[model samples]
Target: MPYDLKHVFASLPQMERGQSKVISGDPKGNNFLYTNGKCVIIRNIENPQIADVYTEHVHPVQVAKYAPSGFYIASGDSTGKVRIWDTTQKEHILKFEYQPLSGKVMDISWTEDSKRLAVVGDGREKFASVFLWDTGSSVGELTGHSKHINSVDIRQKRPYRIATASDDTTAGFFEGPPFKFKFTIREHNQFINCVRFSPDGTHFATAGADGQIFLYDGTKGELVRALGGEKAHSGGIYSISWSPDSSQLISASGDRTVKLWDVGSGSAVTTFSMGSGVNDQQLGCLWQNDHLLSVSLSGNINYLDKNQPTKPLRVIKGHTKSIHCLTVHKGDGRSYIYSGSSDGNITRWDSDLGLTECFSGKGHTNQVSSMCVNESEELVTCSMDDTVRFTATGGQEYSGDVVKMDSQPKSVSASGALTLAVCIGQIVLLKDKRKVFSSDSLDFEPEVGALQPGGAVAAVGDAEGKIHLYSVHGSSLAPEGPLLEARGKLTALGFSPDGAFLAALDDQKVLTVFTVADNYSVKGHFYGHHAKPVTLCWSPDSEHIATGGMDMNVIVWDVNDEDKRIKMPDCHRLHHVSGLAWIDAHTLVTTSHDSTVKQWTLTY
Candidate 1:
């Protein structure tokens, strides 16, 4: 491998309204795991930005839990398949796989010995399954539920017991090596959302949509008492996590608040208010050692501060949708990567600090098609909402000033004080943040565009595989030369940092570099991608070009030598590379439809 993966900013867990998300922490309390799309994400508890992704699952994953031994992880998917894999290695080798049920596997639990497994979810025939972890053999009959089971748990100590919560508003308890359904306790009036056994195996708790939490004897399944009088919260409780000592617990509710309860006194201790918006509803939580974490409906993870309940210690934020475009900017001796997603959300990341924050104020309403940084350190972006926006990167806020294009923009470019935008069938030029020229009359349809760093010319590629050169005259563009032809329809175009060369990629999987001073003569024609290339970026030295395509590959082509190229295959598994940029000559940044931003170090 010519490049090493230096950092990965993983995506947030996929959230759904009225559904409970599972966040599992390792036994050592160093890391936590969650599921988003078909991939399972694991991150360090202390530094949430340090992350890893497991991409072997063929279906969307629902939950992932680490074994008590802390050496392996068992993740379940929508197809009811559970895969147990080794966690000590970077490759994450699969240890075993089994289809325990016929439908979605919502939750999973392992016994104290980490030998037996209990899985529960929405199955057609059976709502739950209990089996041996090493073999696909049944160990118990998990029955008595007439509807879908929402959560399941097994005692972490001796006198093994299993518990499950279901939509039937009842909690089931079982005990034995070959666990069997003992009895069903009908305590809640609405659907039960979660069930868990305390770490000491002394008590178990169940929370429901009726805003009630019932404590029961872990061994006998006997109801002991209810927390917070008759109700624990104003809205439905989604999840709960018990303290390690089994004396207190925290519950996350739909009312956008998480409350700490004292089990011995049966009263609320402290309430942490998330927010008042709909996206602020708390969905999941985890108690690992001294850390208390909760996930909101907006996919933001909050670290609870007991001393100050009003403000969280920190909130980790990132994109929850597929990223479409990205750009790199250097200011104050620090590099920053800005990414835009399909949901009109933009996130800025500090490359050195591994910190991320989203832009505030109303911005684009649709997919961000293209982005580039101008000399003024402003991020110039064009979106499918038929507008081009200029945002100050230092302030990290939208400027509200927008330039409305005549049609939906496909690409945007910035050079000094000049900005160019290519629309569906028109072209627009802007100066000083105001539109100065527009051209709706064109013989060819433009698909992408680029601007020379010296603000001398604008290169626009058409749908018919032609590169149309236009010289910049004040704020308008005038035709410069004859149309340069390519092998297929043009998909991406870019000018080098020194404005000495121009690179273009086409649907035919061909990359062509043209020398700027030689009458736009071809410098080299390179071929590497197996599929159509969609995005391209030039190195700071203007000596190399990198292109990413639908083939899930990124190839860096040396302009001086056509045959000298480095290819990174399967850069983003199960998704296409959507954007590319360079923080410096050796540092490359890539974004994909997987909603992740990866930083790589190129070794020349």
Candidate 2:
């Protein structure tokens, strides 16, 4: 008796990004933070692979300071959606949606008491507003700026002061819950990027695109002095941070440099130049305890601890595809990886083990669709859901209870610590039993054909003859559409043993190989045997490639020698071989539409 079944994978503890336990202090200068393109990430640091207390969000653009209690965080996104989530549980506790004018929220801040939060962004009615953190209630009205706000900061002491920087080239100062407008200071000729309060709450500083730095008495809002201008940075200054003693300030700029300035003398003390003159253009910076965390325009989060030199202590990475599978390796605390296609192929990978292993199995009944690889390397496939089954290297099968799907599962991928299943034309994400991120219109609506995930990259093939690539960054995710444009329908996709090469197939009966770091290309195409390739695989050494197609043949091609081709001479003489897998450098496996799985030995 066969039936469709949905099983609950055990739940592990959830982690929030920016949680104290995850990023207790700033990392050494060489480390960079990874984001899931939404709001989640693993914090790799001096410790041993800790995966807890990281940020999680749906449609979030940016998150604010941790409240004094450290129990929650205020996050805002491009849709003008603001949410307050429990830091420990990674759950959204409160939400504030302002779709009318919600552009990208540039920054958010919390007062010392943690009772109030301020959100500033590009909006229609108003550019900024102050609100209560616990409730979606407005506490103060935003005034003064006629342009987009770039940054905001709340004084964490008595006589609470809120300061905002804007593209209008001015800094606006206001007071509390009734947030009355104090006075506007015209200090910079360009946009002010950031404002910060000293730890003692006595003073603050502002850095702007004009390359100018200004310091003022926190209590008076009166200008104390202007330090550096055009001579300070060859480019715009994007973010600023303060030291514990309040004796010095650190500013990151578009010029690819970080400068430490002495408050009293208002002079540069030490300067650190990012390597190779790449000019990464640091855009965001934060000071936690004695360490400094800075964000670059290219989505890199850098940790700088003035005490260390050689390299960063750690680097965290993530992705945005609707996670379809997750396998945490036992014993060694390692994990392997696999993802299904939008059309119907399954790719296996060695993730946590530090090696690339892609196993191409008999494709899904429909499109090599949805899949899950457990600790045992047994992959469960869920296609149109008319049938649920498990597939292994030799095409082994486990009868799974069938649960019919309302629509074909177009794209299946995984993120965070969960697997996600996506239905066509739907934005809602099904996380086994829970629902995660979603949107109104995903813009592109092609039947997903193939999928694969590893090393911060998720590849999904679509009916539009395109393969989309997504890069997972901590909390800031974006999709690179049509990474590989095919001349025909992309039927399958895979990664080489080292993950350096991405393999793809099209209805044209061609096998295409690409460098994952770049675009899809002709690594080597199996043109000798198959008329229309249905599936492909890379040998264990990554030096050879195997392919199966409608021509009823299983062919192996030596990637290093394009002139030679190996053929099993109609291994499935009566039917098309629908799947293929390279078991080792000298052996392989195959499955045919004729409902047969065969083992084959590859001779030189």
Candidate 3:
């Protein structure tokens, strides 16, 4: 068996209502990066499909910047901790870690030599810190702004200089080897949001909430001119990205537009409207080679085409929220992974090719609680919106029949054409989206369920840590025998591929396996998971089982050998595993709240 990672489907940059999310592109113009939870995601500039995630941070990361040399990356988190790591290797080994501020570290900048770093953020005493990259030795002070700093950048040329944007409506400039505060420019009537030096270090620009872009000489920090003659953007400017030649720049704004500006001419060359919705507001921008990119408040990354200003060249879309459920459906010799996030968005991923295509029509309005592939090769999903939706296995739109669930659905399972959904107060059984049997007044509260592959048996777990077996009668279920009880409240349950065994997990952190052939007799009680395991799938050979838990660990248990198991600890950093599915007996896919889906090869 081969259990190593093959590919990662990275999450979209995390977005908030008013916060400006910072995105940085590498100097080499090959990759761009942003933060989602504790990880910094780096993806190819041209092919956004190829990505890598740095998960060494223990706190929620705010920003990540690639070194000028493109060999190292410095990322900062909510706790004001900055971690410098190697980007050339797969492990991303830690090079250095420093606590730059007492509060959140909002931004980081590296000098052209990559020998020094300046970090700025909200802190109790000082809002910024400047130190040597090799050692934490202090090199200078950033003390002009009274309020917390929002952005910072270091000049790339010889006469080293640093600039900072602040909530105080001012832009501060400094010169360094041992950086020292030079002067503060208070031309903006509103808060300054971003500042950046040109690639050639000949000039620098600052954009602010006042809707203005002020250009200045890089060496002397003298105000050169302001773009647009009036204001750069109609709404507050949030970010600016300088072109490689330092001759032009682009700014993203809350006005739902991105503008390309000629620095030397001080004129707007082109303007692109993102969309009218509030979520379409441009929050971040990047200029890499011929590709100009902007991040909308909705978390979609847009590729701006200078020749066609009205329409984007392409739009990269994915979930920006925590994923909660996932399942794998294999058909036509290809495996498709379906994932549902907390926001009700559903995406289908190709396991072998590492590709994704989101559904086209309107689907769930709220979080999708559970999903399974039914016998007729349709995806059956239940959600918090009080409805069930079905999508064709290979189609891009909803096939039209939407089943209105009687109550809040907690879990769902399907076997061929038969499906069983456990609602908060009801258990509804359906065939092809048509409700066949439903009972809202069960004696025990149904928590989770699993339907046998042959659609002959059903296992319903309740809050009392009991697994109730039922025989599939024409359209209804009949109790089979004594309940299989465990030590804690049952959380999840599944039947083995061969229909010979059944597995149930409870809050007590115990996984109890029972033999279906022996009147549901105890088969094994595995107890290695330190936390409640919510996701489980059996191998094709039915000899091994993989479980993912709230402890951020993925454990593969050997059924025949009680002492043998493989554990992958901290599988997705601070996020818990949302679900798991087997691509093959030797391959497994795990999705998590981190908004990432990972493919792992099992080695035996």
- Give me the candidate number with maximum TM-score: 1
lDDT of 2 by residue, 80-173 (tens): 7666666555344544443323676767778877788788878885888787765657788778998988788888788898888888999998
Clashing pairs in 3: 1-602, 1-603, 1-604, 2-601, 2-602, 2-603, 3-601, 3-602, 3-603, 375-416
Model 3 residue 108 CA deviation in Å: 1.1
Tens-digit lDDT track of model 3 for 1-604? 3368887888999997667789998878899999988889999988888999888888899999999899999999998899999999989999999998998998899989998999999999799999998898999998988899999999998889999999999989998778888889888999898999999999999999989999999999999999998889999999999998899999999999999999989999999989888989998999999989999998989999888888999888778888888888988888988999989898888887666778876788899888988877888899999887778987888768788887898888888878888898788888867899997768998999999989998889999988888888989988888878977898888888898889888888888888888988888889888888888888888888888889999989998777888888877876888788887888888889989998888887
lDDT of 2: 0.57
Q: Model 1 misses residue 93 by how many Å?
A: 0.5
What's every prediction's RMSD, in angstroms? 1.1, 19.6, 2.3
Q: After superposition, how far is residue 201 of candidate 3 from its true place, in Å?
A: 0.7
Cα-based TM-score, every candidate: 0.98, 0.51, 0.94
C-alpha lDDT score of every prediction, in listed order: 0.92, 0.57, 0.89
Poorest stretch of ten by lDDT in candidate 1: 480-489
Candidate number achieving the greatest lDDT relative to the actual structure: 1
Give one digit per residue, the lDDT tens place, for model 1 in 100-208. 8899999999887888889999888788998989987899898999999999999998889999999999999998878888999999999999999999999999999
Candidate 3, after superposition: displacement of residue 136 in Å? 1.9
Ranking by TM-score: 1, 3, 2
